[model samples]
Target: MATHMTSKKIQNRMKRRVALNKGMSGIFLLATSFGVFILGVLFYQILTEGIPYINLEFLTGKLSTNPDRAGIMGAILGTLWLMAVVIPVTIILGVGTAIYNELYAKQGKLQSIIQTNISNLSGVPSIVYGILGMTIFANMLNLGSVVLAGGLTMSLLVLPIVIVSSQEALRAVPGYLSEASIGLGATKWQTIKNIILPAALPGILTGSILALSRAIGETAPLVVLGIPALLLPFPGGLFDRFTVLPMQIYYWTLDASLVGEYQFLASATIIVLLIMLFILNGTAIVIRNKFQRRY
Candidate 1:
């Protein structure tokens, strides 16, 4: 009788624990569903208001004082020029820094300090980078609010992210690969170049591309650097004045409160911006998946 009572008590306790866990899981699911529902509603609203306004004329024409005639051609060209500068600079510097730290730097206080600073920088506000860019690139270097200055500023903001991600990717490579390369009479640089980099390329590409995507969407830094939303000419060079899709959307959204029709224009521009982001993110996903499968 005593043994039976003990087993029954244990079974009751286990049942209660399971019930509690199920209740907590149900609550979490409800919360997640609510958030998704809200996002779905917002996307539906944007699609409804923006789709009708998007046309070839809206895409290829220049911004105008008249709402019906406004377009984002200049903004699109400017954004592309900015990316041309940002992509090369960020990849070179970010990957180089990661390689040095992970593959060459000796473990010490200096390395720790560098690592800490890089991590801290990842959390710094975007507007702060803009100020730094304004003072250094704009005022000191006389780059002004041109494409080069904007691109450089955005690169700085995303540099830390790239470095951290690259480092993680580099560290993920198997130690045996490097050992084998060395055993085969390869130099340190040769091992890294021939074996490590190819193995790590997928992670590096995914991280860097994601960072660039974030840079392209940033508005605060550009605003601080004084990018105007009214660039009439298409950006033909890095030195030319430029404005990006986010800036145009921002200016139009503000104007929408007064003109009303500008809201539809803003929505249409947002559609284009979303498409650009989707393409970039999709590319990253594909590359990441391909490398994962191969490796």
Candidate 2:
């Protein structure tokens, strides 16, 4: 009887496992079909409206009244300058804060306050951030809506996001790594800098990519802060006012008069934006995989 009962239990467990595997395959197939459907729709729409307008002139020249003469030179330059400032600052501040919180600080009232505020800041509306930029960076500092002001304002908006992701990445590192470092005669700071940080660098980089992608696609924040969306000459300095791709896309979508032109430009901008996001995400994934193998 005992033998028979044991065999029955084994059979029931096998049946349950087989049923779960069957359900898993069905769920995966549904998810894959949805993803492919969306991707195909997006590809078709972008190709339909964007392919015609994507010429050398549009890619490399200045915005012009000739329509044929217009291009994204200034918008591209502005975006580059924004990223040049925003990325470094965000990484330094956000990752620094995360490292301190996870590897150094103990759970205390102050830590709780900081965590709560950060979580709240992350949920705050993007438009609210725009208003803050306008009031503080632009108005108080009198930066006069230059690229620097716009970038800094956006920097603050994305800082919380970076910090949150960085903290999570750092947290994912096993506590034993730090414990082993401590046992090897390194100070806490040295252990974090040399051992923990290098191990977690890939994850932090992944967060940076996510933050930057958000920055690149943001329009309301730049627009509300008064980025000139139609600059003809490419900006030569960070302090110089500039246009960004999202701002250009927004401006194009504003008027019904330039329907074909606007639709064409919007689709092109979408393609450019998507391509940039894909490259950054791919790089992050590569780094994550590489570092995971290294340590």
Candidate 3:
């Protein structure tokens, strides 16, 4: 009888455990389904409202106060020019900092402080970087609100993300590969360049592209930098004052209440921005798949 009672208690405990597990699983599934449903609704609205406005004229024309005549070509060119500055600056500085921190920096108080600050900076609001840029790059440095200033501001905003991601990718490389290279009489720099970098390339590229995706979408920094919205010539180089897709979307959305057609234009710009992000992320995925190593 005592043995029977113990078995019954054990079964009851197991049943409760199973019930809890199933309950949590159901909750997670429900949450995921809710998020996906919301995203589907948003995409549906954007597609329905924006598709009619995406003609060649819309894509190629210059910005105008007249909504019908307005085009996003200048904005597109400006965005591209901004990226020209951001990509190289972020990759070189971010990757270089990561390499120094992970491979060369002696682990100590200074390194710990630096790492902690970088991690914290990654969480800093984009607007703060904008303010910093406005103060230093725009005002103090007299760079004005040109493409170069905006690009550098965006670079500062995303730099910590790139550095942190690069560090993580560097860490993911297997130690054995480096050990083997060193055993083969490879210098430290030689091993890093030949073995470590190639092995970690997939993760690094994925992270950098993701960071850049954020940079391209951010409106707050550019807005704070006072980037113009309309009637601007195409940005030919970094020194020219410019606008980007986000800025256009922002101004159009604001003007939408006055003119309903501006809403559709804003939606169209959002679509283009989404397409650009998709292209970037798709390239990252392709590169990652081609170079990804199991070990």
Assess every candidate by TM-score: 0.94, 0.87, 0.97
lDDT of 1 by residue, 256-295 (tens): 9999999989988888999999999999999998987343
**Global local distance difference test of model 1:** 0.94
Report how far off residue 122 is in candidate 2 (Å).
2.0
Off by over 4 Å in 2: 1-36, 256-259
Off by over 4 Å in 1: 1-17, 293-295
- Residues 1-295, candidate 2: write the lDDT tens digits: 9999999999999999999999999999999999999999989998898888888888888876555566887888888899988998899999999988877789999999989899789989899999999999989999977888988988998999999999998888888888999998999889988988887888899888888889988988887898876644788897888888888878876742655577677788778777888988889889888878333
Clashes of each: 0, 0, 0
Residue 165 miss distance in model 2 (angstroms): 1.2
Per-residue lDDT value at 240 in model 3 = 94
For TM-score, the strongest prediction is 3
Residue pairs with colliding backbones in model 3 are none
Clash count in backbone of candidate 2: 0
Positional deviation of residue 141's Cα in model 3 after best superposition, in angstroms: 0.7
